[model samples]
Target: MASNNTPVSAQQPTMRRVLKMSEDEIKKQIRSTHNQTKQKLDFDPFYLFDVVKNILNPSIIVVDNIVQGKAKDMEKGNQGESSPKACFIPPCMLKRLSYEMACKVPGEEIAYETTISILRNVLSSYPWHVKAVLTLASFALDYGEFSHLADQIDSSDQLTKSLGILKQVPIVLGRQGVEKYKNSFGKLNTLIKLTLDVVECVVELEKRIDGNNTKDVPELSLAIENMSIDVFWTIITVVDCMSRICALINDKNNTQELLPFTGKITSILKSLTDQIAVCDRQIAEIKAYLKFKRDLESLQDIVEFFKKLIFVEESHNLQQATISNNELSKKTEGLRKKKVLLFFSDFDISEKVVSILKPICEEESRKDQYEIVWIPIVKNWTDIVQSKCKVNEKYFWYVVRQFSSVLGIKYVKEQWGFKDKPIVVVLSSEAKVEHKDAFHMIQTWGIEAYPFTFERERELRNREDWFGSTIDFIPDVLTWMKEEKYIFLYGGEETWIKKFEDEATKVTNDPDISSEEISIKLFNVGKTCKAKDYLGIFLKNLNKLFFSKSQKETELDTKTKEIQMLLSYMNDGEGWVVLCKGHKLVFSGNGTKVVMALKSINDGKQGLHKSTEIQVLLKQRYNEIILPVTCCKFTANTNSGWVHGDCAKCPECSQIMEMIINFKCCHKGHPTKAVP
Candidate 1:
């Protein structure tokens, strides 16, 4: 056989050998191509379909040495249905190609949202089938992408849509068709996993569809419910197909040796089942919550109560206000400006009247000619009225004794109510009034006293019910606030505040005043601003003040031109607003006859006077009226400075009636003693 030329060299690669590749080389080629398709397609179904469309063509694969099939046309490995008529590619070949793709697709990277959106949108356009979605989901698990798959499938809005979709992917899969040939693509672990996954998905989808009958759970409310249904279906499909793959491991005539193939199959199933169960438990809680939602209607009353409190308690605020309107000056134009020396019994009028007086002096429209005795130890009418309830008297002499302190006054306390009490007298004659800054006294000429007013004891019985109202206060406060000429008192008499007290500090007190309509568009502001209705005092005193000012203006007591011009305001009704008792306007009298009530008691007595001689005699001459004596002094007998009985002085001519005097012109005169 070794003939000439050592004939024929060592045999080169034979024709058959040239046509074939080594097992390792074949795997590398398949694996390299696998990575390329998977990278491009990713989780994109349309993209994968496109890749299949591009790379797969007739004659690309040969079956039994005949080039009559595409790569997807290989059915020896397919586990499920045949290819779509459009695809013309067998499902077995598609499974092999897809397995190779998913195996190469790494497990680490997978974003569910992108894949899910594409799947849902693709379904909307082409078909209502869940088949493609389940297939993609199967591929995901092959690459450890179950979570990504679950996330996407759970997008079904309601259980209705989810179950409806689950119904399409086969649940109790036929044991004969795809299941019989699932392991044809042997040794590629990902391929077997993918086949098993698809089958199980179909089954669990069937269970979800079946679970709908109980109607126990709602639409997919939680993340877990959707996952359990979807993944449970996936696990069953995997288990069933993988069971066939288990047999393939023993038949090991194949090119690959997937070590522990059965274990991988079982381990994956365990992982998926456990994950699905966890999802089920989580969803169970969500369902329970949905079934027992609380009734919101029970809290309606309580909510309303707090809403009202929000207005009453929180909206309530204390606001210091200043006197804005100059009705005081305008109304009392013709009145003489003189100092008033009050002889209070138990009444304290200082605190109540101080606020009114500060504005009167600081008012831009007033002439500051008089000063008020800012008297102190001023009696509070309430304290005085509440002082007496005698413990024992057979007929109750203590009743009037209690009211003896009631000086017939009306007032509002910052801490109490607005009640009309009697005018109270001064408990202390020593007025610390001058101590309260004579300069502050110089600003306005009147004292504010809210003490019990007992000045008129008889009338107190008839006017017990007279008080104030706030309805007419808007116009008065508005007039003062609009001009920036108000008196705000942040503190009491100890720290009486004038309108312009802080020269450099800006006015922080916001007097919210309406420039228009008197009472209609009103807003509540400032604490002290509330009880603004002093109508009772003003109305009762209005006509007396109005008529008197008119008479005084015409008569001209000062006999000066400036006084005449100033008093002219009294002749008009503009001056009457301040004196109008908005508080006392009851059903007692109508507008016309109300003016007559203001006429002074001295009205009827004034007719007896003619000239200076008659006034002098009436004031000086003894008229036989017994006078209560001021305390007496001991002239000769003195002990511890105690005094009793009074010293009599002549009322007529500045002469002591009981003391000796020489001049007859200065002698004490009796009413009958006619002096020439």
Candidate 2:
């Protein structure tokens, strides 16, 4: 029932370094920093220790284990991969509380900061009874770490889940534990939110390093300067304190209050004092901006020189980037058209459909009076249009950037076509197989699928009996025809447009009605053709889908799922080593477990799976002390099954997705491997 946020008063400090400062000295430091004068300030030193001593206690490990245990239990139950989440009554007045801080709530004003992330869940938002709760809550909010508790908030059965988590804040983030996050994850900027959380924590430690608790500590600043969003204040303070301490330790002027702080205290305080003074001076200058225009003008003289060089560099980059963006935009736009649907399967209904359209499209000699459309059906397709048009792949993203950029999507969705005409979609053969669901979704509305044969049309149009004018290649010509006039529908949403079949009958009963007069136009993909060399042609065009970011979602989802599953297997219990015979050994999977397993058994990337290497090593290390964790997961290639799962419970909401794992399932619409 207990968690890390519980506050305890006074215990021997584990990472609890302490310092002593005189009342006069503390008063002077606080006054100098705040630009205020204080007379005869009195505070009880013993009581202050009583208040925070437990904060540094070693018993925090017990607190962490208790909380971690709660998490384990949450995962044991089968709620699936994440904690069971219920929709909390959406607090009507508050919206993204982090961004809403400008409203200036009362106690929050004291903790006011622009960079603070909203408390991720209720524990952080309403941390009652717990003293450290308020402080840790403040820290969590400061670094935008509220999201780490997303699983907790979402899984929360009710407000009580949050309350439970609020109880364990203190011990869970204590020095040694906190340092683990700080040193490895913090330095690398692995998780920005996590880093910010650590930054908030380190800031607390940095401000406290002086050990003069009487003075108020400044809140951590979250605004980024240049690219430096992750400098840990703890490292800065330690280095600063050591530097000054080295100089002062040689000077033997030991006093009563600081005698307790002893050597390093003097230098650390001096450095802090100097830095604060400079900051104070800068703040003063910014505050007098208007009044100091003349002085600023002097500074402007230097800025002007820097401005010219910066402008030139920025302008050049923008120009090149803009031109590149324009070309890619044109290519993606070109692919959006009322093109015909061409299938590459022989003896399929596609041939019959193309036969039907040929008389209309190719029979320019016939008075059909309708525009001919061209669509192609190719298998194993992607949304990439670069090689299909031979343009720079990078331009796709650049074109995307020309629009609004947001999380996940760098570019805003671009709508093509004018209100004056109906859009027709061309479906390729591969699309039908990949988007069978999309077809159903369209069928719900009643649209028909069609196919086309541009190869035959090209031959027919090239003959002297034709208009006697040569045209762009069939596919390229169809792409060029789209322009700002029409949008292409892919797969089945086109079927939905045909759902108004009766309306199509009512509006333009004549088969010759122009697309410009209709609200929705359905172009049935009619013909199919078998490619003589499908694989070779497909691979040659693969470059576009492989490189063009126009279809970036396809790439990102694959890579992300791959990485997630990859990390999951590494963290899973499956990647380990155990001795069965006489020696130690490593097991299946790679990365973390593989590296650690190798180190344990003195093995390398020796292609071991399902405990293969470990079984062999067991023959040699039977006499040595070893730890063993069972590995699972069976494959056809090997005669063994390896186990992989992180059976951890939800720390917040108590909901758990059993055996945390991310798999790319085709049924789930994640295509990591080939369709087969």
Top lDDT model? 1
Q: What is the RMSD of candidate 1?
A: 34.7
- Cα TM-score of candidate 1: 0.19
Model 1, 532-649: lDDT tens digits are: 5333323323322222234324553321221122122222222111111233212121111112212211222332223222223222322223333221111111111122112333
Which one is best on TM-score? 1
TM-score list, all predictions: 0.19, 0.16
- RMSD, each candidate, Å? 34.7, 31.1
lDDT of 2 by residue, 389-481 (tens): 223212112122121111101000011111111122233322211111121112111121122232332333223222101111124323433
Please report, as a residue range, the 10-residue window in candidate 1 with the lowest summed lDDT: 409-418
Worst lDDT run of 10 residues, candidate 2, spans 404-413
